[model samples]
Target chain A: MNTMNNKKFMMIDGLPVAIEGEKNILDVIRKAGIDLPTLCYYSALSTYGACRMCVVEGKHGEIMASCSTPPRSGMEIKTNTPRLQKYRKMVLELMLADHCRDCTTCDKNFDCKLQELAQRFGLKKVRFEPYSIWDKTDNSSLAIFRDPNKCIICGDCVRMCSEIQNVGAIDFAHRGSKMEVTTAFNMPIAETNCVNCGQCAAICPTGAITVKNDLGPLWEDLHDPNVRVVAQIAPAVRVALGDEFDIPRGTNVMGKMVTALRRMGFDEVYDTATGADLTVIEEAREFIDRLENGGKLPLFTSCCPAWFRYAEINHPELYDNISSCKSPIEMLGSVIKERAKQQETGKKPKKTKVVAIAPCTAKKFEIKRDEMQYEGEPTVAHTITTIELANMIREAGLRFEDILPEAVDMPYGIASGAGIIFGVTGGVTEAVIRYVLGSSARDHIADISFTGVRGFDGLKEVKIPYKEQELSIAIVSGLKNAENLIQAIQSGEAHYDFVEVMACEGGCIAGAGQPFVLGRAKPERADGMYEADRLSNVKLSAENPVADALYTGLLAGDKAHHLLHYK
Target chain B: MDNKELYQQIDEIINAQSSEKPIVAILQDIQEVYRYLPREAFDYLSEKLGVSLAKIYSIATFYENFSLSPKGKYVIKICDGTACHVRKSIPILDALRKELGLSGEKNTTDDLMYTVETVSCLGACGLAPVLTVNDKVYPAMTPEKAIELLGELK
Candidate 1:
């Protein structure tokens, strides 16, 4: 909060900088355009000053951890001095001594903070030898793996899970030299109540935790001659995958991704947005029937699989309220598989394998669930993160930027703006509001956007007049925020007609499966989704002619209910 | 004890303690009931206290007083301080372990009758070469005397 009207000033490296409303000295130093290297600092989490790399010199020749120390007015803080520089280097060296030095083969090779800091400081040699406490890596979880040997013990992942998600699947165990992060009783992660959200992997500063290698199975599927590999891209993936390819951040690179997939031997590429439209239509229908026919109120949206699983495990009371809609990728995968197996007019069917490319690690877990399977067969053969898909593109030796853009294949290519905007927080509620309003007109759509269901607010409440009655809606991202809302609802302090929960803050745009993103870069991805929506011809889900054609043709009778929803 | 009994006792302990850090207190009571923290108790306590298994396990492992495995009915504590070591406490510890047929990481007997352990001190430096069975101290204890004491207790 470096404001113009503020009178508070602090000398950062002999330069007077306005303190404004900055609570911590680290943020005050950041106002001066220089950041101290810290492995344990995240803007969204509580101040954990474990990593002493952010230490600054005080006027009285004292040292202070800038992240936890409060910024005082007229304070003289030297951000970088000879003593501080030497101390920082020593800290890095000491942290490196106990850390795993195998960086070249590590998943977080270039992305690792220690590796980056070592290169930044031109560290040629380490005076100390590596002595690791834990040697085994936990590969029991399908979505992510934890390598205890590489853990720097920053406690960022710990805070992110317990404080942010309100899910304490892992915590620091033991003491002193033998301390390690692990599940309760040191059980395998698969045995714990881990929802596989991948936020822990996303927040891990080293290769301590990361998404498991998934390209092996995908490549094997592509190479098998008898297998028909169909790929469906999630709505959030297209906007953020460009972060890996160095195409401008948050740019819509779906076409290039489609081209890359086609070259890598995908039989068909479909947009999961079309499936999101199905969610919008079905979720709205359920909401209206509940509103009119006296059913359970506050129909919770079930688009985010991580949120769905969290609710499934923790809040059994809200089971009836949670919509039975399968996630967009699952919905679309079921349709693709059903169509592939059908003996239709244009049919040369082999064993079909539906691969979902999503910006979610939990989708991997969701695909393997018992309900998502029909008659002992999974709706989706496999789910790969956006990062894994990018790796596949690079492995295929294709120049992504030079490749021509291509459209998703027919039968499910065309989608509504309502579907495309489902990537961001409150985007689903706004989409549902538009459908409930029963309008495709530009004015009505614009009015719905103004109903306070946009932007990156953790929790937003909107009450819209539906017919003669008012429909109350609450949209929240992050499980902690959902926990607060759930508590309020259970205690009878609040009520809403619809509640949408996204486990990750800022929705799928900031999903852990996407490239490493800081808190600031999430809005850019949100903007990309809105921009894509603004450019689409069809503004409403029900108005999309392709969806209308779907209802009349392929999804006639109980087929739509069977394929698009979880029973 | 069965899981239901353990869970009920844990609940009783929790209801009585009602403190901020009740897990440690509840664990102590459960250990008193079964002589060690049972595996099933960790999962039950995790759900009952709304605390993660990691947090409870950390507490259970952090304190040296709590044992994860079952301790024998008659626990043996041999003092190994400088005074006791000079008075030949090693032979007494070895004799007890050998008598119980326990070695290396094994401390408890197969019949669960005796557990042999060495403590740094027993606060009785004057009683050098000391040992304790079930907190009943035996001062200036010799290897033969310890074996004879164990045979009498049995």
Candidate 2:
């Protein structure tokens, strides 16, 4: 594969750039600092090249899409010639003609790629009339909003959902002008087995698909002096929230985040990592019990809501294998609500609402689940994404970057390194491994990190010797990888003692509700999670005092079983 | 249909076409049994076959012959292919629709007696303008002739 003996060079915009092993001409040009406008092309997914904006002129003045074309040894590629400009402009104008341009009030107003491309291409006016039949918005889904009118029909969302996630909840329906990205029978997406992952929403370049922003309702609650609102920040959010404030990606902004939330009327703020510690301990217990007592092998971690739902509906037989423990968010939510009900915090509101901040869209729907609900009301009142928290921070006019560092409130704030690592893929397994092998097993802990169990890969496998048994583990992010692993297990091709499934590829850090990333938020955010873990004084979940107190105190007898475990 | 009975009927069709590779064959068999692809059938097939409902709907909608809604007892298909169009098939289709009180959107009549639809071709191009009633080809038809033919059928 290394054809390095003969060097290849491709001329992009008349500048000769050496191409090592780049797949497409677009990649070569992009590596040479050319930011080509593309709507349907994502490096994570297969090349669609339908947008036609990334067209480059060839040697014979032939136009070819740079995204789909392979880079030749000495290919002449002019990115921005007059003809290319004209074509790109026309493409923009055509897209604009039917684009439902209420740009000032669109969900993706400032963040839209289509809007930026329109501005970049300098589309003054559309030559063609608005020929599209305006469709009504689909607001049926609990987590996602679908406005078909604003869609440029970029297949990024389509590929992300179907190809990347292996959840074909939507696909190309009808033909020509009537064509649309729709669920079966043009039914409401909530009716389908969509899993509510929102990876499609993450990849959607336009506001056609967007995560449901619960900010307005949150604002109403914040304004109401009666309601005591508490916020729990996910470990993933701490690393990524800084992206919105330009405070460098992967920087832990938990302290500043706490200050911002308090300023914005949050009565208490806690870290979900402490809740994650509960999950690791409980899941590990469940796994060990199953291994000992002839229960289902390969106990699936149920921390990921999207993956949990995916298995619940699609592979119902695996229901027994999935861990009974609630996700970190739900576990914390239950504890917070239960505590609020037990201890009367001097009653103006009469009700305490736990508003969890997560780097997930599925978490929105996760809060609404009947199991997540305590009596009739949800344990978590509302689950807001990382971006929504940023919006609130911006609304409060707090200088997030310069805010004085503040600690998270009370007993729930503390979490171990193992818990913090739960933000990224393969982290849940790694954490469980660290828990099973005690904190003192430093050499074994170092060995686990090297044994293919701590990377951002969509699918990872590792085996560790424990007692008499060799505990085999498989960690998968993205539904496609999960689906593949499931098939292998079903076909007797694969066997594992444990499996961790995260619906979003590379886990919560690259979730749909997080900041839109062009490439996979791997090494950057994954490294950040690992770095945060390294800096934590306590390495194992067992070592965390907060978790230990929970195991001994609050979570005792039937109450712990009821609060932490979901039936 | 009730869930059990609906599932029962679809299960029979699936079992019949169990060895069949193409989903189209199963769809065709179901269409034969039910006269149109039921929305419920999509739900059943998608789950059983592991093919997406969106893709099933797409294939259903793509083919002009495949119908999503239930069809009428007397199904009238007027060919509007190149030869048929040149030979004035539109007037014949218009006459049938006008007589049956059917519009573009409303294909089936209120009485459930008639459904008038346009097709690309019947592959009987030598007949110039042609229309079919329940697959019985009527050759060289005019507006008056089409109306007369409908009257005879009624």
Q: Say which candidate scores most in lDDT.
A: 1
Q: All predictions: root-mean-square deviation over Cα?
A: 3.0, 2.6
* Candidate 1 chain B lDDT trough over 10 residues, lowest sum: B16-25
User: Clashes in model 2: which pairs?
Assistant: A226-A349
- Output the worst ten-in-a-row residue range by lDDT, candidate 2 chain A: A1-10
Tens digits of per-residue lDDT, candidate 2, A1-567, equal 223457788777778888878889999988999899898988878998889988999989999999999998878879989999999988898888888899888879888999999887777777777887888899998899999998888878778888888888888777787778888778899998898988888888899999998998888888887888989999999888989999888888889999899888888999999999988988888888898888998899999999998998889999988999999999988888887777875535357889989999998898888888888998998889988888888878888888987999887878988899999988999999987876555556667789898776778989887789899999998899999999999999999989999998888888888897647455688888999888888878887899888768778778888999989
For DockQ, the strongest prediction is: 2
lDDT of 1 at A512: 88
Q: Residue A187 CA error for candidate 1 (Å)? A: 2.2
Clashing residue pairs in candidate 1 are A184-B53, A184-B54
Candidate 1 local lDDT, A20-108, one digit each (tens): 78879998888788967889999899888998989999999899899999988778889888999889898888888888888889999
**TM (B chain), model 2:** 0.87
DockQ score of each predicted structure, in the order shown: 0.61, 0.69
Using TM-score as the measure, the top candidate is 2
lDDT score, candidate 2: 0.87
For the record, the alpha-carbon RMSD of candidate 1 to the native fold, in angstroms, is: 3.0
